[model samples]
Target: MSTSSVVTAPWRLLWRLGLRSSPLALAAPLVRTRPDPDLAPVALRAAGADVAAEPAALESAFPHATDRIVVLVPDTDEDESAWLRHLDQVGGTYASRLAALLDWTPVNVRVSPGEGTAVEVATTLQALVDGWPVPVRRIALIGHGRGGLVLRAACALRHQTPDAWHELVSDVVLLGTPHLAVPAGRTMVPLSRRVDEELAGIVTDDVVDVSAQPLPHARYALITPHTRLQQSRLGGLLGDVLWWRHRLPMRPRKARSLFPSATLHHVPTHEIGLVNHPDVHQAMLAWLA
Candidate 1:
């Protein structure tokens, strides 16, 4: 943490906590150098309403899949769009590119992951994988926002079953995932006020420490924005039930990997667009290659 960022963290927290009262907004734009977004003309649209459920296994599920698969885990948001469509919007494109690069087929979990804790999500993910009835030699996980945390937790959750799918994940890509709490000027996007209601309840005070018991046989690439840490600048400041916490504060803290050995890529974009940003996707493709 830089001296300026550390010194200013508490005040930033105050502004983030109080929402509108803090002078941090004007002052932040002044003191903190906001990175140039340099945004491409991308349609940053939200997904539409939900659709009826469909069969789990289609006739051509993973037709190009061999002994390898790349799974895209998207954050559970209010976007009621079909899971597959939303996944495509978020990281499915990168997944397809990655799959083509490595001769792996991209796929999503059998069902939309319902409500659960990280461990519960992990177990459910594994159960769904087990039921797939497909031969798998290796697995690669790429997740955005909270979905990244779920994927990390699943990787950490040891599997007792013989030759489990969890054991096959060789690579993990975390897009805009917070891995710490009350970060000191840690580069991250703040949780949207709305995400707190649905996501905050479960991820409260939870920490996915990559430092301890590092994921075995797995390489990690954490991609997040270089922008300021806080989000919800316009939303109401005061939240009920303490909604500010995350898996924890994540990013390059003090010019180093907050995730220790993991390679870090910083991009210029909003949290959601981390998956869409070219720097992020390019770094992802390079890392996997």
Candidate 2:
């Protein structure tokens, strides 16, 4: 362990103890809510819910038209309209910006809230790929949070049965995805086990062992935030402990061993929000390119 880890170990323990003393803290599971697969979008739509928009019309602005397509998947409980509005408001014309910066065509996939699971979302993506107007020779799958998990599931399905869409995937970019498992502090686990068996089960089945089962052939990139709120610091530390306990980072490393290459990037940002940062946009542009 590093010197900083050794120094913080005692502090982490104290924080865990303090957190355990609270009944409210102990009541809730440390894991994120299960994604609702029912909300998975049935079809791809323009960012503003313009079903009438043509893919060709959207791609017309690109100076250097290429067969490459970039698909954006939002987090759980989010869809394309909300994602696009947020990106435009904070990211400042991110789609157009990316189009202007790269040769690839950018589009957003609308996923339903509370009902989009990895497998279901993957099916939706596959359908999009099958029906795309152009012959998609290359694709870059960009997902945020749970959406990343969906992409992984899609890749896994493709791996099982090779198809045109699977063959075309050139890049998979995951932003702030907890690939190994969701980080619930060490202290919460014992409390959860003692209090609610159902919560404990959820933590074990859904949070603890959620792996991407990443494809060996595809290039992958994992991006995380370096800066988070102090309130979530203990949870982050405990999450790291869970990672250590399970030897989790090894999953990605193993995937990297099989692929052409894989890269991990940590962008400095507060909390789970990094999509709007100019640095993040630049890094993504560079990576996608």
Candidate 3:
């Protein structure tokens, strides 16, 4: 069949499957994460990395509250070693957590897991600021992968606990994550679905009800590559050309909706090289500013 025919065929199927031509919205419905009891915590001792035992000490080290805040939220299931591995593979030039903190110097805090679902990390942050020296004015959050989703969940929970949010919470920023794909939109569709199935209570319609809140007091900056948009956009334009020649369905933009208050931005991997774009740290800082 002709290349044109191939492109048209899949789009038709997608349309039948409820795909809409209108630009995809950035906001996603409330989604939650389930703890993997089977995945034992890899001893941090083996990884040889220093992880803070106390959440408050971690918050105090960097000053995200006074001026511009950078909160580092890691993937839901990933332990410290996984974070280190990601940094190492990226040539260690930047610590994913540290790099984000440095972008906006006011203060940087790294949120950690605290005895519940990954969402607890956000709750933990709330607990830390019960009576902070300075009230959290503005926030700039940076979450990686599932951690990004956790950030959204954190914001959602604030509504349920207005007093807690008023006390210490501010705003959020997300790193490389796909917000709209809840269970089947894109990016780990099966994973999202599995999470929704097992934990239906939290991952309900309001998980990220962008329409209701419209514009939460936050700025969200997302970095995506067309090639690596799904995985990594390495190689070159020639490679992209070849990919389109053979790859099917015309890669759809897999993105999530940020509240109307957000200033949404994208960094294509072709120019910067896909997969893990190095400039995300800077991009986030500038967006927050």
Candidate 4:
């Protein structure tokens, strides 16, 4: 058979296998994993709600509320409108899968975009939480592509700021994040390596491998899975055609922080692909539950 013919079955087979093995396949009682005892009972503050001055007010309102909020902070302000649109589609797919599997409302929290790199994003999160009456319980910070890199850097930033680590973070999740460096058009290789390597030289913090740091006893981690989405439209259309195959990198990549520990969950590129991968996000939700 031709290479094109070969592509059809292998991906399908992998998808089937994933479905059969996951516990998420069976009905599982998923709930919020991290519950902050110190946080006073309070309601869920609306998005853009005032978490700046009285972040603790949230804790007081939904002390026992499931604080599994998703923070939507993009790393750069560059008008990747096209890319962001694709991400929104993927995010919606992820939300749907979560709803079908666990029936939970997916929370999307947003941090400012273009403010800075991963560290800057984390700094923003810190500032937002510093004044909180109670900190978030089961926090799941998720970003797409470059946003994921920013999220990784933000997790590392949390490690540096011990005070912020007290009750704000739980698990950091990335959707189709690139951890290595790639050329302008290549989709498989990460684009952040050059920057991370450069930063590693200036900062004694060893910021290059931002994924390796341990956060405040939280389960610091990453989510890398395969998807049809590529770095560019042409790449996406080709769909994992050699250079566009997205996966975790070998060197100078985002290291899952030991402070919180990390896990790598690979998904098939088609059928139940990363965006719709049953086990990947569902497993995290299960674990967090």
Q: What is the TM-score of each candidate against the true structure?
A: 0.55, 0.61, 0.48, 0.46
- Judging by TM-score against the true structure, name the best candidate: 2
TM-score of 1: 0.55
Encode model 2's per-residue lDDT on 1-289: one tens digit a residue. 0111112343443343344465466434333454455533533556355332344554543334457778787765566643444464465544566677776777676554343445555665565555556666888887776666566656766434455566778778777654443334455454323222221111232432244456666789776544211223344434422222223554531111111245756654422244655666776677777
Better of 2 and 3 by TM-score: 2
Model 4: how large is the Cα RMSD against the reference?
13.5
Per-prediction CA RMSD (Å): 11.8, 8.2, 12.1, 13.5
Query: Residue by residue across 113-217, what tens digits does model 1's lDDT show?
Result: 333345654665565456444666787787766666666655667878886777887888877665443323323424333333222212223233443344768
Per-model CA lDDT versus the true structure: 0.49, 0.52, 0.40, 0.41
- Displacement of residue 240 (Cα, Å) in model 4 is 16
Q: Which wins on TM-score, candidate 1 or candidate 2?
A: 2
lDDT ranking, best first: 2, 1, 4, 3
The per-prediction tally of clashing pairs is: 5, 9, 15, 27
Q: Which residue ranges in model 2 land beyond 4 Å of their true spot?
A: 1-42, 50-66, 81-94, 112-116, 159-163, 182-212, 227-262
Q: What is the lDDT of candidate 1?
A: 0.49
How close to the true structure is residue 95 of candidate 3, measured as C-alpha lDDT? 39
- Model 1 spans with C-alpha error above 4 angstroms: 1-60, 78-92, 110-120, 127-134, 182-214, 229-258, 270-272
175 Cα displacement, candidate 4 (Å): 1.5
Q: Could you give the candidate ranking by TM-score, starting with the highest?
A: 2, 1, 3, 4
